[model samples]
Target: MARADALEKLRETLINRRRALVRSATGELNQLQGRSAKTGDLLDAVAESLQSELNSQLLEAESRELTAIDDALERLDQGEFGKCEACDRAIPLTRLRAVPYAKECIECHRASVKRRSHPAATINRVFDSYQRAQ
Candidate 1:
């Protein structure tokens, strides 16, 4: 694809996501700041615990997205922006339109998803060990 086309797509994505990002971050900050004024330590612990979990997940997703965008931009600099990372094939324009941060072609992405969905580990330790032992 042309350089102008890639830039236009990138700008559109930035414009669409920027306001939402700002709103999310600002809302979280306001809640965290207002928390102390509105409640005691016990209530604050509950609220902050929930907010911290939520914010952590959101931040992680945002970090992944930013990394992808940076990778795409770097690829553009090297004139390989639309190539699939897994297969070294040219990613389809339609897929690129739908997902500008896609690093793999459709086939490879689907295969990867399939593999991820059936993860081998059943012992994901999200629960405390003592609780589990009980």
Candidate 2:
């Protein structure tokens, strides 16, 4: 069916993207390491070190995204593609196209981002529920 075809297309896209991310991250890490070997003026050395640190952080983030892409591929193989992991609803094609590795539908994704950005509120809500039980 069309859904299956779409899922397959998305799967291919995710695989290709994962490959590109890995290649780019590898190149960045290599450049950072190689560039660190050179000695320079005090200010230049400081700046280079800072840049290397930033690149390392970015590469780490890319690694996390690579893991997500792999998980999406696995889900596609299991016939669970195109469904939100959080709510079990169908993820829109637009979202899939925008983020081929997305595991949450748009609504759930928004709620998740809100929860992450407001940990204090989440904790307070949990504490309030506990108080109601007493």
Candidate 3:
């Protein structure tokens, strides 16, 4: 298929996915809110609070994904949809198929993952070093 046609298809898919995600997230949040209002017992209140926290985290993640989808749609409008933002290389159709909102090519994405140093990794390394020194 032509690049423009592919981009249009991807744009439609992302928009639909975004709508579904928003609806699901909204329904779940509403359920949690309703449940929280009726929790009279301490344990029930605690459980509802935990559920609400988890729902909030999930909603946060969904919101981020929604933002990415929106950005991809904007990029489609700008005629830069399939190009990797990091390397300016054409992102593979396969990758775009797998992740409609992907911003970087596989190689650039892998390099970015490699370059990142997580706090958990640092903490683990420090603990291992301290254990070895004992």
Candidate 4:
């Protein structure tokens, strides 16, 4: 449950998962390509639709997980890996084991979830502000 051990486990897991994901994606891509060439119009359409949805889901999950891993690595480099983002306290080792990519401790994370349940309008406002500054 040491910080370094937690980081090491997360790093290893991310690497293995990424390798598996790449293999899975390649297999799916090859299957789709074959189906595109061999199937008739109706069958091809269905295959294409299913393939598209599968690809979307796979890519989304991969991207999200990779981002989390990368963020964790960045924190590792910063020597802030086991620290909570919200309260600026040390994140519990047990919690880190449960959620290797955790940015905040449990209480802060719950607060964040509550806040995000209500959508914010800051996206457009931030973009507008940036454009006006430009």
For all predicted structures, in order, the TM-scores are: 0.63, 0.82, 0.80, 0.66
Clashes of 1: 0
Give the alpha carbon lDDT tens digit for every residue of 100-133 in model 2.
Answer: 7778898997898787874323333432453375
Full candidate order by TM-score, most accurate first? 2, 3, 4, 1
Give residue 26's lDDT in candidate 3 (0 to 100).
Answer: 95
> In candidate 3, what are the lDDT values of residues 30-129, reduced to their tens digit?
9777884483788888888888888886676666667777888899999999999999999998878767777888898768768995332332333245
Which ten-residue region of model 3 has the weakest summed lDDT? 118-127
> Candidate 2 local accuracy as lDDT?
0.77
Instruction: Write down the lDDT that model 1 would get.
Output: 0.61
Report each candidate's C-alpha RMSD, comma-separated, in the order given: 10.2, 11.5, 10.4, 11.3
Scanning candidate 1 in windows of ten residues, the lowest lDDT window is 119-128
Give the range of the ten consecutive residues with the poorest summed lDDT in model 4: 118-127
User: What residue pairs clash in candidate 1, if any at all?
Assistant: none
RMSD over all Cα atoms, model 2: 11.5
Over 4 Å off, model 4? 1-9, 22-35, 41-44, 117-134
Total residue pair clashes for candidate 2: 0
C-alpha lDDT (0 to 100) for residue 118 of candidate 4: 27
What shift in Å separates residue 94 of candidate 3 from its native position after superposition? Answer: 0.5
- The CA lDDT of each predicted structure is 0.61, 0.77, 0.75, 0.65
